[model samples]
Target: MYRSLLLGLAGNSAAEALALRYGMRLGASRFVAGTTLGEALAAVKALNGKGIAVTLDHLGEGIRHLDEADGYMGAYLSLLQAMNREAVNGNVSLKPTQMGLALDPVSALDRIRAIVREAELHSLFVRLDMENSPYTTATIELVRQLHREGFSRVGTVIQAYLYRSAVDVKRLTVERINLRLVKGAYKESSSIAFAKRDDVDSNFKRLIKIRLDSGVYTGIATHDETIIDWTRSYAHRRSIPRSAYEFQMLYGIRTPLQESLAREGYTVRCYVPYGERWYPYFVRRLAERPANAAFVLRNMGRRE
Candidate 1:
């Protein structure tokens, strides 16, 4: 119930306004690097210093206008340039909607293509983030189109909670597209998603195994120690090299665990997000773990 409530608030514009006014003082700073690209780059540098890679996200989505989407594309292009100039060991992730997929699919594709082209020039990878169920098909299609157009440096995420992910994973694997396997954070319907945590975790493990066995590089994005342990054991038993996959975790969620995995000589990447439109991303982070809400509330009175 708590998780659902937070997810619901993720789209509440009035609540978002309040959050913007308060900025990171409401404890969003723990999750969001900052509201600027420079801050995000610094965070990336710090993570790189710790032997951890990063995938930076300029957090904005649910655009109502094409102009907004263009602005987002501009920001991404700038982000790509900055990442290259700074020589940071990181890539980029973006939501399809943020590029106008919902408002105008064609224009959205062009915008995303531009960003991907820019990223390719820097030899950086771009992970098209999977949104809710409504946009899942379109997001995957966009990725397919990009790959066909020679944007081989691009990839997309897969949510294990979804019933269709297995098929999507197999097909994308056959295409040799890299993927970041996540348990998903959206409030999806039971008809199309696994509602029970056990079911989701079980499916997550299944998907991880499928990708690992395919001998394709995968990003196992999760914070569950159990799942992490299972992945480690399975990979070891299968004789999969550490280079075959990397463990991905959200920023500020499990610092010690991320570093521990890195210290163990395993590749670990942090999903570091920034930008002014952080309320939605912040709420989703809270929804993923209600304990995070409690922590945020407890620290709400404190100043950044």
Candidate 2:
């Protein structure tokens, strides 16, 4: 119930505005790295030193203007350059809406194509983040287009909650594109998404197996220990190399688990999100785990 409520609030514009006003004081600092690129890069460097790879995300979405989209693209380009210069072991993940997919898809595609090419120059990968159902088809299609255009380093995510995901995974497998599987965080409709944890988990495991067997590099992005252990076991039984797939978790949510997996010789990537506009992303993180929410509640009365 609490998770559902927090997920619902993730889309509340008023709540987002209020939360932004309070900024880091809202206890977002625990989840969000910081509000600047430098802070985020520092965090990335620390993770890199610890043998953990990183996927840098500049957190803002639901863009409305071409200028806003252009800025995001520029920011990503700069980020990619910085990573190369700093020798950080990381790539990037971005939302299509943040690139103006809703306002003008052609523009968004152009922006993403440019970023993908830039990443190519830097020898990095780009992952297109899947938003809610409204953007699912578009996100998948965009990745397909990129692949056809020879941007093989490009990839995207699939949320297990959506019923269409199984099919989407198969279709994407044909393209031979890399993918990240996530248990979705969006507030989705019962008609379209699984409503129970058991259903989601079951589907998640199914998707993981499908992707693993598909013979592509897959990212299993889950904090659930059961899923993590199962993935480890499944890969071992199949004699899959550690390079065949990697484990991913959010930046601050499960530090110890991430490190342990890395120590165990698993390729682990941390989703490091940083930017001033972190309200929506932070709230979604809260919705994913009750313990994170409780931590925030305990510190609510205290100043950031």
lDDT of 1 at 153: 92
Candidate 1 accuracy as lDDT: 0.94
Q: What is the TM-score of each candidate against the true structure?
A: 0.98, 0.97
| Best candidate according to TM-score | 1
TM-score, model 2 to reference: 0.97
Best by lDDT: 1
The candidate 1 region of ten consecutive residues with least summed lDDT is 295-304
Where's the lowest-lDDT run of ten residues in candidate 2? 295-304
The local distance difference test score of each candidate is 0.94, 0.92
lDDT of 1 at 110: 97
In angstroms, how far off is 22's CA in candidate 1? 1.8
Residue-level error in angstroms, candidate 2, position 141: 0.4
Which pairs of residues clash in candidate 2, taking residues 3 or more apart in a chain or in different chains?
none
